[model samples]
Target: MAITFSDLHTEKGIKSLDQFLSGKTYISGDQLTKDDVNVYAAVVEKPGDSFPNAAKWYHAVTSRLAPSFPGNAQGVRFGGKAEAAPAKAAATADDDDDLDLFGDETEEDKKAAEEREAAKKSTKKKESGKSSVLLDVKPWDDETDMKKLEEAVRSVEMPGLLWGACKLVPVGYGIKKLQIMMTIVDDLVSVDTLIEERLTVEPCNEYIQSCDIVAFNKI
Candidate 1:
């Protein structure tokens, strides 16, 4: 199958594009690494099984479109995985102190083995402790609404402007009125600039519903 401006033929695609620009949807069941997400995105947008072609396109477009270095902005994060110090070697002072230093049963070699195991365990903890993203929304309403929204933010313990806003739009509009104005709360890579670009289009909808989504550093 072939794809083009006309080939993106889903009802969601049409309606979304009309209501928002760059009507692209990146859908996934579980979380994915930045690279994995991009690759996944390319594959999904492709017409058929030409995933390799999709990969190439994804890489090429991302190379130009994405702000940060490869796999930085959008990727899985595991805290303290790298540069983690190994655990202290098992103290063998309690064990037989008379063991030889060089023999297979020697204390010195046993210590080395224990050290390696400790290092592996430490590394695993660092790799698995990465956090997941939590998305929250704030809508544009009257003065009372803003107060309510602020209270909601406080209840969630999220900070100000650090999160984004998005709307579940039903109208087929994109790139025009910019229904979502994802204001930046942090000096994050590409977010500020990307948000500006996304707003280049109009945000118009006959029946539009909107909410704001921002990224809050999950404490």
Candidate 2:
């Protein structure tokens, strides 16, 4: 349940983690695409399987909740500093209403919304925040750095609570191979393994490093 100094440094990885203890998007990077978030759910929520188009999210979700030893970044300690991993896979699709993707109604949420609206109208302040992903900056956009980044991916930890945080399942994708790659990223333990299994060659380390699996700590 211990969030390292690194995770806290990023705004997108763990949104207001100290102030908001639970909810999806609370800790994972803001740059995460819809697929990234969904894959996160499959890995932790439905570990041992990969649903299409959700790999990066799988990595982000698992790192925050991977079953780990105390003080380590693996295994999520849910319902406390970290939420506990659910004991069972959902019994049916109809149970969606029970999922708690965001935190419940609280005085803080109400006050914060009011304050934000007041600030916007009174000052008309337009804070300049950037989107999570900037296609222009992606290393893969440059072949040279991509190699180096994948190496970094191998060393990072992904947790499992991502499953609890989401409920995404892809029906299809706009691009074929890209969707396939997305599938590869969906398996927490096997994103890298699947690459090796299919390609019979190691993928670039940058593929790993460029990975946006890192998440915000919510405990």
Candidate 3:
């Protein structure tokens, strides 16, 4: 019978029990029986909302059967009441007490935390101070002056400029551009001066037409 009723799988069939159980307290005769348990389990396996009769009967039976159990049935709510505010507050206090078992931080631990945070901020500041620049270096004619171009790029020796990769790229129309990637210190004024000196100096200036910064970005 349980399998047969469950296999019905129809809304009307499942809700049919609502009227049947309206005047009765149990699914079989008037008292609880194996038939009631079997029917309740079958109904719960179906959609809870579509089988309102089944959901109500399942809850009614389970509550009476396991009222004192530590846990409630999954997906089945009871009484529709939340925990009282005082009880929730008490639970929070208990959680705090449990966490307090670890004790307070020592002075050394506090000092170490401060030192770590300070070091982190200092590192971030140093990184933010550094910047990258892309320079477009062109020669006078179709001829390429690799040595002069490289010499010019390295001529400006400054503490702020940390030259990384220097390469000559050949662009269209017989012009080769010099791409220079470097890291500079926080002093932007010194960096600008160094770049100005590199482009205006002899060997580099003789072979180069015009030098301009194409792109710039912070690290």
- Measured by TM-score, the strongest candidate is 3
Error of 3 at 141 (Å): 1.8
Q: List the residue pairs that clash in candidate 3.
A: none
* Decreasing lDDT order of the candidates: 3, 2, 1
The C-alpha stretches of model 3 lying farther than 4 A from their native spots are 1-128, 188-191
Can you write out model 3's per-residue Cα lDDT over 1-219, one digit (the tens) per residue? Answer: 222354324567667766566656667555544445445444533336655656666566554434333364432223542222222222233242242212466565588789989999988867656678777767777775767776767776666777778777888787677777777776553555655666656756776776777777876
In angstroms, how far off is 78's CA in candidate 1? 52
- Cα lDDT of model 1 by residue, 4-72, tens digit: 233233444433223322223322212212332323232223223333333333344333333433343
Q: Which scores greater on TM-score, model 1 or model 3?
A: 3
For every model shown, the clashing-pair count is 36, 44, 0
TM-score of each: 0.21, 0.18, 0.38
Off by over 4 Å in 1: 1-111, 128-144, 154-219
Candidate 1's error at 122, in angstroms?
A: 2.3
Please tell me which predicted candidate would have the highest lDDT against the true structure: 3
For residue 64, give model 1's deviation from the true position in Å: 66
lDDT at 167, model 1: 38
Between prediction 1 and prediction 2, the one with superior TM-score is 1
